[model samples]
Target: MNRYDNERLSAIAVLESLRAGVPTRASTKALPDLRPNLLEIFKEDLKIFAGGQNLPGKFVWGKYGQGKTHVLASIEHLALDMGFAVSRVSLSREVSCHNLFHFYSKVAVPLRTPNSTVFGLQRLINQKTEYELLNSPIQNEGRYVHPLPALIFEDYFRTEGEEQDTLYGYLMGNPPSDFKSLHKKARGEKPILKLERKFKPSEHATAF
Candidate 1:
């Protein structure tokens, strides 16, 4: 097949994946030439995200076979390349936007990061745990007393064995019941709590 035929076949394959309710592989390149205007709009939104600016919400509307899924898959590929974690969930009767809980659950089910195509949440927690271990002190005096590493594990171990559970709850649109307690457990120090609370809710929420 020539280059044009290959691209056409690739696009068709992506559409088939979408139809089958599977995410396009991260290695799949977006055929922006198929929808130049939509791709340009996605690029602009990505620029705003990369620059650490607040991006306004976008609503994409199109009929069947109008390349909506293709546009979305293209955006996902670009977002991952730009170091942003992304999740794509189709809105339907079971995962309606009107229901926050169900919607969050659906979104969490498909979470993806640049390095992960599946089980992204588990990978995220594992990586963070590794980071904490690496940053933890080896010396006797500083091992337990260091505030940073203690705080890290505290969050990881907060609520006894419910650390992962708590994380799941948070990702599914339920903030932990006691942020204060979680913070204290993570830090194990009274002095640092005051400094931590100074951060705004938005800042604190994005710490992950």
Candidate 2:
């Protein structure tokens, strides 16, 4: 009777066809139309950024069910052929115990570090904020410190099920460190975790 019900009916029709092994009408994807041109643009833009020409990132965004995910999958497929760093996240598992920490090894009975009790996480990777690096003994004890790289966040607007809102909050609220810079990326009035980087990159990068 209403739009929501109609949407449900349409989805059911799609499912019914799949279940019955009936073929639905097929159409060409935008990926075949635009991937090469987009990849070339990204490569040129990345070169400019790497060379310190003050460029922006290359991200793609599209409306829901518009095959954006499929396009991203195609990109990942290309990445594999080209040997690029790639990963896909399942927002459905944001709070799973397995994601928290899997490798377990108890640090003998005497966990001697004094500040260890203060921090919640057991495993500590040294992180270097600009201030810490300048002031601390890090120069004396040389070590690279960081979080995951080029964090890829997909499905920002997924409506998966009961856990959907929770997972969305996790994504919008506490983004991984690499994207801490984009932390200010928010929805309406809610303020999300953001990075200290200047607005230069976010300003120029075009998504969609």
Candidate 3:
């Protein structure tokens, strides 16, 4: 659906509205308003990711509260709606080895893929999660038996931070299984994009 000017937004729009948990009582199905510039950026993204197209390494950065998280959430919902694997997180807490390593194990959404690999997603901008869930085992004739590819997407970024290079490095290469294990055996890791240091100091500490 042409979000710029349409009778109604497409399933993507509906998914985004839902992810945001916003109420859109105006219609039986809620959707996001394209708002011109927003629609243009989305269209550009589509063009870049078209079938057989080669997309260069790119980072999406915007001022705080400028809908970056919303856009990623919408994309994730869109992926899920398309029968793709998806896992997600919100880096609103402290970042520990446990926080970095717990990229998988979300299981699955109630209505979709019981055996599909978890979707790795996070809401912390410019942070890094040490390990990625990679792929997960799927069911064969009787039970989940094979591994399926898991797609990773990011919500926000800190642009240039201490973990910035390390975070991007983790996304491009293979990650060890014990990558900063909570137990810290020094042997475990997974590869994927993530948020870092976002969950430090604590939110209530600044109220003084």
Q: List, residue by residue over 72-160, the lDDT tens digit for candidate 2.
A: 55554444344333344433444332423210111112222323433222132222222343454333322312111111122222223
lDDT for model 3, please.
0.37
RMSD in angstroms between candidate 3 and the native structure over all alpha carbons: 17.0
Instruction: Output the TM-score of candidate 2.
Output: 0.27
Ranked by TM-score, the better of candidates 1 and 3 is: 1
TM-scores of all predicted structures: 0.55, 0.27, 0.29
- Taking the tens digit of each residue's C-alpha lDDT, what string does model 1 give over 49-156? 788787888988899878677677777887888888899776678878665454666676678889875754755665554345555452233333223333444466
How far off is residue 154 in model 2, in Å? 34
Per-residue lDDT for 143 in model 1? 32
Per-model root-mean-square deviation over C-alphas: 8.7, 19.2, 17.0
| Candidate 3 per-residue C-alpha lDDT over 22-133 given as tens digits, one digit per residue, 9 for 90 to 100 | 4322222244554447545655655566554666543557898676655665555444444454444444435222422232222221223323343232222223432322
